[model samples]
Target: MIKVGIVGGTGYTGVELLRLLARHSGVKLQAVTSRKEAGMKVAEMYPSLRGWVDLAFSTPEDARLTECDVVFFATPNGIAMQQTGELLDAGVKVIDLAADYRIKDLSEWSKWYGMQHASPDLVEEAVYGLPEINRAAIRDARLIANPGCYPTAVQLGFLPLIEAGVIDAGSLIADCKSGVSGAGRKAEVGALFAEAGDNFKAYGVAGHRHLPEIRQGLTRIAGVDVGLTFVPHLTPLIRGIHATLYAKITQDVDLQALFEQRYLGEQFVDVLPAGSHPETRSVRGANVCRIAVHRPQGGDTVVILSVIDNLVKGAAGQAVQNMNILFDLPEGTGLDIVPLLP
Candidate 1:
């Protein structure tokens, strides 16, 4: 069995990791760290795991992370970089569910995240953990930099077009909306029910942190620097990400066929039949990205709708998927969870 440890087990992504790992047949939960919640039973803090997780949260200092086969950092950005080197040296594979090592350019990452990268040397070494794009690299990587929530949705929507050279990569727009839970389990005025609920508004138009990460991934796929205007909105719901992507068509091809063929063998990416609009709820609670392609009135602009559960495909679930790849397990092992629908 693969021994696993999770750092930062108090946030939404952290608990989501626990929920998924608890039932993984091939995994043995070794340790979960939470400085503040140390000594608290995992089930006591999150009743959802009452019967599955009997381990108590331990402080990072007390956790036996080096002994685990793989350690997932579900903590904030800086935390992982601070300790990843030691973990990797100890033969422990590390997967960071944060932006600590996603962007290859350390200066650019610093500019956007507003913090000096603690381990800039590891930036180039950490493979970006998007299985659809970097599956081969992830298999041999000891350090993984998981893609951000918005980037995951937006990139999956635009990848096929970019790869086929059918869309103008110079001017791409990602108008994405995410649920309140994407903000993490925090006590912030902006994330409070009274402020986020019954409201729909876009923030970070000036430039969200995910913008660079998206551009970086798209640029790699397009083989050129891609221009992207990414705007993120906060919806009142608790889970899901809806990304409406727009790109100018440079060629005329059957978009439905293109998407279908592009993701023909991808287990997590679902390409809907033509004229279908994917809903975020359809992918809720599951590690899946449901997409639909359209060219309204046969215009030059092509629109793609992509949806996924932010905490699942966008975070913890994707982390687990990467773990499966790293361990040479079935790609869908422990991730065959059906989407939770209303």
Candidate 2:
């Protein structure tokens, strides 16, 4: 079995990884690290894994992780930068669910993340872990920078249009809403039940950190510079991301024809059947990303609606998908579980 270690295992994304990896037939979860929860049983914190993962949370200094074949960094951004190089140098594969190695430009990463990158040189070598976009490179990579929740959904939704040059890159806008869990499992004033429950509001306006990451992805498809007005909203729900992307069409186009032709035969990314709308409830706990397209008359813009569970496809689930590719395993192995619909 492939031995796996997860750092920062006490967070929402780390626990989500444990939940999914517990059922993977070919994996042995060797270690999970959490400084605050060190010496505590993981199952105690999350009863959902009572009988599955019996390991205790340890500190990052634990020797058990160095022995594993692969390590997942589910820690905060700065935390992973300090340890990823050591793990990779030890011949262990690394996957970071943070912002440490996602952006190619170190200065840009530093500006948004509010700290100088500790391992700026390694940034170029870390593969972007969006399987649909960079699967080939991921297979040979020792470190994978798992795409962020918002970027994953937005990039996937708009990639087709950018590729086809059907929309003006300067006129792009992504209005995304994510569940509270996307902010992490911390006791911040903004994440309190009182602050989030029964309320919906936009927080990050023009300069959200995710803007650069999204632009980086669009640049790849457009083969040139791209810009976007990215606004994010915090929903009272616990786990999902809905991204509504709008862009001015450069020419008259058929929405159905564009989406259908672009996503044909693409696994895990589905373009809904004609005239159908997708919901976050339909994709919760699953790796699927459902998208629908529309081009209403009297408007020169086209709208692309996309939805995904922020924790699943947006985080842990996509990390597992990257792991599958790194090992030459079938793209969907151990991840074929369907979405748990309401």
Q: Candidate 2, residues 1-342: lDDT per residue as tens digits?
A: 889999999899999999999999879999999888899999999999999999999887874777999999999889889988888888999999999999998889888999999988789999999988898899999999999999999999999888888889987999999999999998998889999999999987958999999999999889989878999999999999999999998977777788888778777898997667789999999888999988767488888899999998999999999998898777777788888867
Alpha-carbon shift of residue 129 in model 1 (angstroms)? 0.4
What is the alpha-carbon lDDT for the whole of candidate 2? 0.90
Which lDDT values do the candidates have, in the order given?
A: 0.94, 0.90
Clashing pairs in 2: none
The deviation in Å at residue 258 for candidate 2 is: 2.8
Q: Which lDDT tens digits does candidate 1 get at residues 194-262? A: 999999999999989999999999999999999898889999999999999999999999999999999
What's the C-alpha lDDT at position 328 in model 1?
A: 96
Q: 150, model 2: CA deviation in Å?
A: 0.5
